[model samples]
Target: MVQEKQSDRQQRLDNFLQAVEAAQKVQDDIMKYGLEAAHLYCDDIDGDWLETWEEDEDGQQSFVELVTNFLQSDDLVAVKVRKQLKDKSLQEIAVNLEKCLSLSEEDDRIFAVKKVLLRGVAVAESNRGTSSDEIDEIELLDLAEELLDKLAEFLVSINR
Candidate 1:
Protein backbone atom coordinates (compact mmCIF):
# COMPACT_ATOMS: atom_id res chain seq x y z
CA MET A 1 0.00 0.00 0.00
CA VAL A 2 2.77 2.45 0.87
CA GLN A 3 4.63 1.59 -2.32
CA GLU A 4 1.48 2.03 -4.40
CA LYS A 5 0.81 5.35 -2.71
CA GLN A 6 4.35 6.59 -3.39
CA SER A 7 3.85 6.23 -7.15
CA ASP A 8 1.28 8.99 -7.44
CA ARG A 9 2.89 12.16 -8.74
CA GLN A 10 0.33 14.47 -7.22
CA GLN A 11 0.66 12.81 -3.84
CA ARG A 12 4.43 12.97 -4.10
CA LEU A 13 4.35 16.65 -5.00
CA ASP A 14 2.04 17.37 -2.13
CA ASN A 15 4.26 15.40 0.21
CA PHE A 16 7.30 17.27 -1.04
CA LEU A 17 5.61 20.60 -0.46
CA GLN A 18 4.52 19.67 3.04
CA ALA A 19 7.95 18.40 3.92
CA VAL A 20 9.50 21.66 2.85
CA GLU A 21 7.06 23.69 4.91
CA ALA A 22 7.40 21.52 8.00
CA ALA A 23 11.16 21.66 7.79
CA GLN A 24 10.93 25.43 7.49
CA LYS A 25 8.77 25.60 10.57
CA VAL A 26 11.23 23.54 12.57
CA GLN A 27 13.95 26.00 11.66
CA ASP A 28 11.62 28.81 12.59
CA ASP A 29 10.80 27.32 15.96
CA ILE A 30 14.42 26.68 16.74
CA MET A 31 15.29 30.24 15.81
CA LYS A 32 12.49 32.49 17.00
CA TYR A 33 10.63 30.91 19.89
CA GLY A 34 13.71 29.19 21.40
CA LEU A 35 15.54 25.87 21.25
CA GLU A 36 12.88 24.33 23.46
CA ALA A 37 10.48 25.16 20.70
CA ALA A 38 12.31 22.60 18.57
CA HIS A 39 10.64 19.85 20.52
CA LEU A 40 7.35 21.03 19.09
CA TYR A 41 8.66 21.57 15.57
CA CYS A 42 10.44 18.22 15.24
CA ASP A 43 7.10 16.46 15.37
CA ASP A 44 6.00 18.26 12.20
CA ILE A 45 8.55 17.12 9.57
CA ASP A 46 6.80 14.21 7.86
CA GLY A 47 7.89 13.76 4.21
CA ASP A 48 10.50 12.44 1.75
CA TRP A 49 14.17 13.44 1.94
CA LEU A 50 16.52 14.35 -0.94
CA GLU A 51 19.37 11.95 -0.08
CA THR A 52 17.06 8.92 -0.17
CA TRP A 53 16.15 9.31 -3.82
CA GLU A 54 19.79 9.64 -4.92
CA GLU A 55 20.77 6.49 -3.05
CA ASP A 56 18.28 4.20 -4.76
CA GLU A 57 19.56 1.73 -7.39
CA ASP A 58 16.84 2.63 -9.88
CA GLY A 59 17.65 6.37 -9.68
CA GLN A 60 13.95 7.09 -10.03
CA GLN A 61 12.69 10.64 -9.78
CA SER A 62 11.06 10.57 -6.41
CA PHE A 63 9.41 13.75 -5.19
CA VAL A 64 12.49 14.55 -3.11
CA GLU A 65 14.79 14.22 -6.11
CA LEU A 66 12.56 16.39 -8.27
CA VAL A 67 12.33 19.07 -5.58
CA THR A 68 16.06 19.09 -4.85
CA ASN A 69 16.93 19.33 -8.55
CA PHE A 70 14.68 22.29 -9.05
CA LEU A 71 16.15 23.95 -5.95
CA GLN A 72 19.74 23.66 -7.18
CA SER A 73 18.86 25.02 -10.60
CA ASP A 74 17.13 28.03 -9.11
CA ASP A 75 19.98 28.87 -6.68
CA LEU A 76 17.63 30.19 -4.04
CA VAL A 77 20.10 30.13 -1.16
CA ALA A 78 22.75 32.20 -2.90
CA VAL A 79 20.40 35.14 -3.22
CA LYS A 80 19.12 34.58 0.30
CA VAL A 81 22.58 34.53 1.93
CA ARG A 82 23.71 37.60 0.02
CA LYS A 83 20.75 39.49 1.38
CA GLN A 84 20.98 38.18 4.95
CA LEU A 85 24.67 38.37 5.71
CA LYS A 86 26.75 41.52 5.96
CA ASP A 87 29.60 39.52 7.39
CA LYS A 88 32.90 39.21 5.50
CA SER A 89 32.76 35.44 5.24
CA LEU A 90 29.99 35.20 2.72
CA GLN A 91 32.00 32.72 0.68
CA GLU A 92 32.63 30.54 3.72
CA ILE A 93 29.03 31.12 4.73
CA ALA A 94 27.93 29.33 1.61
CA VAL A 95 29.90 26.30 2.68
CA ASN A 96 28.22 26.26 6.08
CA LEU A 97 24.71 25.93 4.73
CA GLU A 98 23.06 22.55 5.17
CA LYS A 99 19.94 20.78 3.95
CA CYS A 100 17.00 20.99 6.34
CA LEU A 101 14.83 17.97 5.63
CA SER A 102 15.72 14.31 5.97
CA LEU A 103 12.73 11.99 6.07
CA SER A 104 14.82 9.01 7.11
CA GLU A 105 16.49 10.88 9.98
CA GLU A 106 14.86 13.90 11.55
CA ASP A 107 17.47 14.19 14.34
CA ASP A 108 20.17 14.72 11.75
CA ARG A 109 18.74 18.15 11.02
CA ILE A 110 19.61 19.26 14.56
CA PHE A 111 23.24 18.34 14.03
CA ALA A 112 23.30 20.25 10.74
CA VAL A 113 21.80 23.23 12.50
CA LYS A 114 24.58 23.07 15.13
CA LYS A 115 27.21 23.22 12.43
CA VAL A 116 25.57 26.28 10.94
CA LEU A 117 25.34 27.93 14.34
CA LEU A 118 29.02 27.36 15.10
CA ARG A 119 30.02 28.67 11.73
CA GLY A 120 27.93 31.79 12.17
CA VAL A 121 29.40 32.40 15.62
CA ALA A 122 32.89 32.04 14.28
CA VAL A 123 32.14 34.51 11.54
CA ALA A 124 30.53 36.89 13.97
CA GLU A 125 33.41 36.75 16.40
CA SER A 126 35.88 37.40 13.63
CA ASN A 127 33.84 40.35 12.42
CA ARG A 128 33.59 41.79 15.93
CA GLY A 129 37.29 41.22 16.68
CA THR A 130 36.49 39.64 20.00
CA SER A 131 36.47 36.15 21.49
CA SER A 132 34.47 35.09 24.49
CA ASP A 133 32.53 32.14 25.79
CA GLU A 134 29.20 33.93 25.68
CA ILE A 135 27.35 31.34 23.69
CA ASP A 136 23.71 30.92 24.55
CA GLU A 137 22.20 27.56 23.76
CA ILE A 138 18.84 29.01 22.73
CA GLU A 139 20.41 31.64 20.47
CA LEU A 140 22.59 29.05 18.79
CA LEU A 141 19.53 26.93 18.18
CA ASP A 142 17.74 29.93 16.73
CA LEU A 143 20.48 30.68 14.20
CA ALA A 144 20.49 27.08 13.04
CA GLU A 145 16.72 27.13 12.75
CA GLU A 146 16.70 30.31 10.64
CA LEU A 147 19.30 28.95 8.22
CA LEU A 148 17.35 25.69 7.90
CA ASP A 149 14.17 27.64 7.25
CA LYS A 150 15.86 29.65 4.51
CA LEU A 151 17.25 26.52 2.84
CA ALA A 152 13.85 24.87 2.88
CA GLU A 153 12.39 27.94 1.23
CA PHE A 154 15.04 27.62 -1.43
CA LEU A 155 14.03 24.01 -2.00
CA VAL A 156 10.35 24.90 -2.34
CA SER A 157 10.98 27.80 -4.70
CA ILE A 158 11.92 25.20 -7.33
CA ASN A 159 8.21 24.49 -7.65
CA ARG A 160 7.57 28.13 -8.42
Candidate 2:
Protein backbone atom coordinates (compact mmCIF):
# COMPACT_ATOMS: atom_id res chain seq x y z
CA MET A 1 0.00 0.00 0.00
CA VAL A 2 2.76 2.41 0.93
CA GLN A 3 4.64 1.75 -2.31
CA GLU A 4 1.50 2.23 -4.37
CA LYS A 5 0.76 5.53 -2.63
CA GLN A 6 4.31 6.72 -3.21
CA SER A 7 4.10 5.83 -6.89
CA ASP A 8 0.81 7.65 -7.26
CA ARG A 9 2.20 10.75 -5.62
CA GLN A 10 5.23 10.70 -7.88
CA GLN A 11 3.01 10.41 -10.92
CA ARG A 12 0.91 13.34 -9.79
CA LEU A 13 4.00 15.46 -9.22
CA ASP A 14 5.34 14.63 -12.65
CA ASN A 15 2.05 15.65 -14.25
CA PHE A 16 2.03 18.92 -12.34
CA LEU A 17 5.59 19.77 -13.37
CA GLN A 18 4.76 19.01 -16.97
CA ALA A 19 1.77 21.30 -16.81
CA VAL A 20 3.95 24.06 -15.39
CA GLU A 21 6.44 23.68 -18.20
CA ALA A 22 3.66 23.92 -20.76
CA ALA A 23 2.29 27.02 -19.06
CA GLN A 24 5.73 28.60 -19.15
CA LYS A 25 5.90 27.93 -22.87
CA VAL A 26 2.51 29.61 -23.26
CA GLN A 27 3.73 32.58 -21.24
CA ASP A 28 6.73 32.89 -23.52
CA ASP A 29 4.42 32.94 -26.53
CA ILE A 30 2.27 35.62 -24.92
CA MET A 31 5.39 37.66 -24.20
CA LYS A 32 6.34 37.50 -27.85
CA TYR A 33 2.90 38.19 -29.39
CA GLY A 34 0.58 39.73 -26.79
CA LEU A 35 -3.09 38.76 -26.95
CA GLU A 36 -2.75 37.60 -30.53
CA ALA A 37 -0.75 34.70 -29.12
CA ALA A 38 -4.08 32.99 -28.52
CA HIS A 39 -3.90 31.93 -32.16
CA LEU A 40 -0.80 29.94 -31.32
CA TYR A 41 -2.71 27.77 -28.82
CA CYS A 42 -5.93 27.76 -30.81
CA ASP A 43 -5.03 26.27 -34.17
CA ASP A 44 -8.28 24.33 -34.09
CA ILE A 45 -10.36 27.50 -34.26
CA ASP A 46 -12.90 27.24 -37.05
CA GLY A 47 -13.68 29.46 -40.04
CA ASP A 48 -16.19 31.34 -37.92
CA TRP A 49 -13.51 32.27 -35.43
CA LEU A 50 -11.41 33.69 -38.25
CA GLU A 51 -14.01 36.33 -38.99
CA THR A 52 -13.03 39.83 -37.88
CA TRP A 53 -15.08 42.72 -36.56
CA GLU A 54 -15.52 44.01 -40.07
CA GLU A 55 -18.68 43.20 -42.02
CA ASP A 56 -17.52 41.08 -44.90
CA GLU A 57 -20.43 39.74 -46.94
CA ASP A 58 -19.08 36.20 -46.82
CA GLY A 59 -18.40 36.10 -43.08
CA GLN A 60 -19.89 37.47 -39.91
CA GLN A 61 -18.57 37.09 -36.33
CA SER A 62 -20.37 38.51 -33.38
CA PHE A 63 -19.28 39.24 -29.83
CA VAL A 64 -21.20 36.10 -28.86
CA GLU A 65 -18.97 33.87 -30.95
CA LEU A 66 -15.80 35.39 -29.56
CA VAL A 67 -16.98 35.05 -25.99
CA THR A 68 -18.07 31.49 -26.65
CA ASN A 69 -14.66 30.68 -28.01
CA PHE A 70 -13.00 32.00 -24.89
CA LEU A 71 -15.29 29.95 -22.70
CA GLN A 72 -14.70 26.85 -24.76
CA SER A 73 -10.94 27.18 -25.26
CA ASP A 74 -8.84 24.22 -24.18
CA ASP A 75 -5.72 26.29 -23.55
CA LEU A 76 -4.31 25.71 -20.08
CA VAL A 77 -4.98 29.26 -18.94
CA ALA A 78 -8.59 29.23 -20.11
CA VAL A 79 -9.21 25.81 -18.62
CA LYS A 80 -7.82 26.79 -15.27
CA VAL A 81 -9.68 30.08 -15.10
CA ARG A 82 -12.96 28.46 -16.08
CA LYS A 83 -12.52 25.98 -13.27
CA GLN A 84 -11.89 28.83 -10.85
CA LEU A 85 -14.65 31.19 -11.95
CA LYS A 86 -17.61 29.22 -13.20
CA ASP A 87 -20.27 31.82 -14.06
CA LYS A 88 -19.54 35.47 -13.47
CA SER A 89 -22.01 38.33 -13.73
CA LEU A 90 -20.91 41.80 -14.79
CA GLN A 91 -20.54 42.95 -11.17
CA GLU A 92 -18.77 39.72 -10.23
CA ILE A 93 -16.58 40.17 -13.25
CA ALA A 94 -15.55 43.61 -12.01
CA VAL A 95 -14.52 42.06 -8.71
CA ASN A 96 -12.59 39.37 -10.58
CA LEU A 97 -10.80 42.05 -12.63
CA GLU A 98 -9.69 43.74 -9.44
CA LYS A 99 -8.53 40.40 -8.06
CA CYS A 100 -6.65 39.67 -11.24
CA LEU A 101 -4.93 43.05 -11.08
CA SER A 102 -3.76 42.20 -7.58
CA LEU A 103 -2.59 38.76 -8.65
CA SER A 104 -0.71 40.24 -11.61
CA GLU A 105 1.34 42.28 -9.16
CA GLU A 106 2.87 39.08 -7.83
CA ASP A 107 6.19 37.76 -9.15
CA ASP A 108 4.89 34.29 -10.04
CA ARG A 109 4.53 33.36 -13.70
CA ILE A 110 1.51 31.16 -13.01
CA PHE A 111 -0.23 34.03 -11.25
CA ALA A 112 0.56 36.28 -14.18
CA VAL A 113 -1.08 33.90 -16.62
CA LYS A 114 -4.04 33.36 -14.34
CA LYS A 115 -4.57 37.10 -14.02
CA VAL A 116 -4.46 37.56 -17.77
CA LEU A 117 -7.05 34.83 -18.31
CA LEU A 118 -9.17 36.24 -15.52
CA ARG A 119 -9.13 39.65 -17.12
CA GLY A 120 -10.04 38.11 -20.44
CA VAL A 121 -13.01 36.36 -18.85
CA ALA A 122 -14.10 39.58 -17.23
CA VAL A 123 -13.93 41.44 -20.53
CA ALA A 124 -15.86 38.69 -22.27
CA GLU A 125 -18.58 38.79 -19.64
CA SER A 126 -18.85 42.54 -19.93
CA ASN A 127 -19.18 42.30 -23.68
CA ARG A 128 -21.74 39.52 -23.35
CA GLY A 129 -23.98 41.76 -21.25
CA THR A 130 -24.35 44.35 -23.96
CA SER A 131 -26.75 44.39 -26.91
CA SER A 132 -25.62 45.81 -30.23
CA ASP A 133 -27.58 49.02 -29.74
CA GLU A 134 -26.78 49.30 -26.02
CA ILE A 135 -23.08 49.44 -26.74
CA ASP A 136 -22.46 52.10 -29.37
CA GLU A 137 -19.43 52.29 -31.62
CA ILE A 138 -17.45 54.26 -29.04
CA GLU A 139 -18.05 51.69 -26.30
CA LEU A 140 -16.90 48.89 -28.56
CA LEU A 141 -13.74 50.80 -29.40
CA ASP A 142 -13.11 51.48 -25.73
CA LEU A 143 -13.51 47.79 -24.91
CA ALA A 144 -10.94 46.89 -27.54
CA GLU A 145 -8.52 49.42 -26.07
CA GLU A 146 -9.07 48.07 -22.59
CA LEU A 147 -8.34 44.52 -23.79
CA LEU A 148 -5.13 45.76 -25.41
CA ASP A 149 -4.10 47.49 -22.21
CA LYS A 150 -4.68 44.28 -20.24
CA LEU A 151 -2.62 42.32 -22.71
CA ALA A 152 0.18 44.87 -22.46
CA GLU A 153 0.19 44.64 -18.69
CA PHE A 154 0.28 40.84 -18.87
CA LEU A 155 3.24 40.89 -21.25
CA VAL A 156 5.09 43.22 -18.92
CA SER A 157 4.39 40.99 -15.94
CA ILE A 158 5.62 37.83 -17.63
CA ASN A 159 8.70 39.59 -19.02
CA ARG A 160 9.62 40.54 -15.49
Top candidate (lDDT): 1
Task: Provide the global lDDT of candidate 1 against the true structure.
Answer: 0.56
Q: Which regions of candidate 2 fall more than 4 Å away from where they truly are?
A: 44-46, 49-160
Best by TM-score: 1
lDDT of 1 by residue, 1-160 (tens): 8777777877889999999998998888788878678557456445454455454455454344443343344455434334334352543444444343543464577566566546656777787886747767665566556556665665565434
Residue 16 lDDT in candidate 1: 99
TM-score of each: 0.35, 0.30
Clashes per model (N, Cα, C within 3 A)? 1, 0
Q: Candidate 2: which pairs clash?
A: none
Using alpha carbons, what is the TM-score of model 2? Answer: 0.30
* RMSD of each candidate relative to the true structure: 21.2, 20.5
